[model samples]
Target: MSFATPLYLCGPLREPRQMLADQQYSGHTSIHDDSMAEKLGFRAGPIEGPTHFSLFVPLLAEIWGQAWFERGCFSSHFQNMVVEGELVRAFVERPAPGTTRVRAWAEKADGTPVLEASASLGPDDGATLLDERMAKLRAPEKLVILSGLYVGMLGAEDEKVRMDAEQHMGDLYPFSLAQKLEGITENSPWYSDAASTPWGRAVIPLEMVSVLAEYTSKQAAFPVKQPVIGLFADQEIRMIDGPLFVGEDYLIRREIVALSESKRTESYWVRSRIYDASGETLKAEMLLNHATLKHSYADYEAEASA
Candidate 1:
């Protein structure tokens, strides 16, 4: 198991204009938008973290091909990096046979490394990648509970429509990869078309996942303003069985599988699982935490006077 002679991969062949266009159409509500990024103090709308993450595909495919899907694990942190107009590189280092180390960094065309990440890979060995021991080792006191209170009250019981992927398929939005890479770069050879790839050519950028999760969160019986405090901590994409095509309309069914409250921290956590029309879990384990505003004596007096 060794990578071909080249041993290095660069991805997303073309610059992704469609992503920017979609951001515009969606009212520029993306986390990467200049205004939002400005609130976070960034230069222009940052390219989406997930979109940046997706750049890993070319190298993973080159090194492990289809096997990467079956036995790959990725854990990333959304650190202080903004996505502006820049050329990023995906680098891989193979120190020994049966072992491949990978790292990615976003850079200017002039070659300054902006964002950095690394991952190690080996055989599965038929062992559970996500096991109880790993969970305990990760967070020993963490509690996993199932709560249906939110779902029982808010979730839609009846199916509204059977979404057709074809109906939604058409001209890729302005900000989509299809449009972004148009005059800037060529389409990724890794992606067959929006509807044909195992992971689906970057039809929907990764930034939208948080949006979807937020929308799904609001749909819950108890809608509240809460930021994403933490994720699964350790999450792996086992298999992307079906392609989520661009313009394809598909049913999204959600269920609140778990909820918990920490008396020590006075915070609440909720988790929901989403399934596509085919009953295959397209995405799962969305976690959200509650928050409260702090009030000073003057603030309390002002509120009291009001």
Candidate 2:
């Protein structure tokens, strides 16, 4: 059946801090670190993206049953942070039979939608999809790998020295609340009514974390040979330590922790850690199968010229 089937999903998520604490104790440190979030300037531990995505799985199961995982494609952009005591909701819209579109968003008790997402699901046919096509186009040149090679080639010579947060904790991003709320949610009550809730305070969306990670990978090298690929395979939001207030300036720094070649897929895997202004690790990620800029249209042109 397509995602357009008559299926509806709705519910409220538990407290954000409790969830994050569980994730940290369980050794789930790939994303936000629950241990030192407050010290890092967060109101509380922030939730991981993957775990937040799962809020819809139950709804999918009701509609698609066991087949949801087999034929569904899910994608989400972290728009705003759902802090420690917020109530998040999930909804689905079915436009056509056998097709379903779902969305999730978190809000304060006053009903401000902080984070939002939309996903589509339908019958899976045995054919290559756009994502696969892109992968094929990216495979031959390996731009991501080449970028890593370039970094290694520099060997500390070109290392971009970053300011340590402990020594310089006050540096912030300076994004205003009004600006941060822009394009996030429509007529958000938090913005219009000055609503308060047990959810603490509004923070930056978790989706921004993903955006930062993608941007950092892009800036790690020069000449822009290959574009970084983002995979939302599995995300887990562990905590929402503190509020990332609007107009508050925050600093982010990334460091590559591990790089290795995959034996099975012959792809390169890169892991990076993101820290906030306090020098406390806010998020850590292991990006798999990122392509490097080894060859491009220029290489093809060179061959033609040769």
Candidate 3:
């Protein structure tokens, strides 16, 4: 694995003075809700993991220039959860010129780690964050959402979806890229103002990229039996050819990579890669671990037993 340029390195990237204040987006029954989050032993609805990805984009942009957004990839493994209002900053070890991949991490004001990852660009012929993790994953013998499913299940066919700035991104993300820019806590004009950067237009923020890239996952036939609410236990988004443009059409295809479980939930991990409109250029990809609460599926025991 090699890079087009040196790995990006600079001083710590500090987020804006705002916190992730969108807990209200999730309904009262969702774990992200205050009461439910507290009941589940969290300090508060831990701010969404995707929200933290914002801190690293500027560093990527600075390192690779506007081209990074076009083709940069940031793959990560989250290490901890932090609440709103917590002060966290991103740091990357400056790589030597021509380095392909480098270590990156986010830490609290006190230096406690939040997430650790490998950030890069282009076709990473080398094993990736998810690829290495998937290689060691073991599926549970019993599952609720994934009972009928097995690893390596591909989508029925290649699914094509596009990002429309005016439309809400289904239930999971009820806001559009235009709407998300309204309260963007990270505070980068490059995300919404075309004049702010050399990309010729405003770019999509990482948080909104979650919606643009993944909102259609619900339409996928993952073999989950019941309609259960799910949360992202882990996620990684990587861009291959170029930065995805706002409101532009992109293509996506999903595949079930692995399955696992925890004491309270069953998990299904899927990898979705985004391509350019022509479907020839590899643009971006996301690996998501969707963990559904066992209790949410009323017949979880029956399904697991079967």
Best by TM-score: 3
Provide TM-scores for the models: 0.50, 0.36, 0.82
lDDT of 3 by residue, 184-303 (tens): 656577766678777676677776677776676655767776655567777878766656777678878888888998888888888888887778877788888888878776787776
Best by lDDT: 3
**Candidate 1 lDDT over residue span 1-306, tens digit each:** 964564445654324332542343222244345575455434666554445545665566577665554344333433344354566554544334466445444444556553454443434423232332233332213322221244333355322222122222112222323433343333354333544556554343222333333443433444322231122222222223332334443344444423333332212333434356555545332333332111211243343355
Report the alpha-carbon TM-score of model 1 versus the true structure.
0.50
Off by over 4 Å in 2: 1-9, 16-35, 100-108, 122-306
Between prediction 2 and prediction 3, the one with superior TM-score is 3
Q: What does candidate 2's lDDT look like per residue over 1-306, in tens digits?
A: 445346445655444333334322112231234454454344655554443544555555566553443344344444455555565665554334455555444454567654454454543322223233223433323333233343222112111223211121111212223443343322234222324423333333333333333433434442323322122322222112232332233444433322332221123333344334554634233232332222222353353345
Deviation (Å) of 296 in candidate 2: 33
Clashes of 3: 4
Could you tell me the TM-score of candidate 3? 0.82
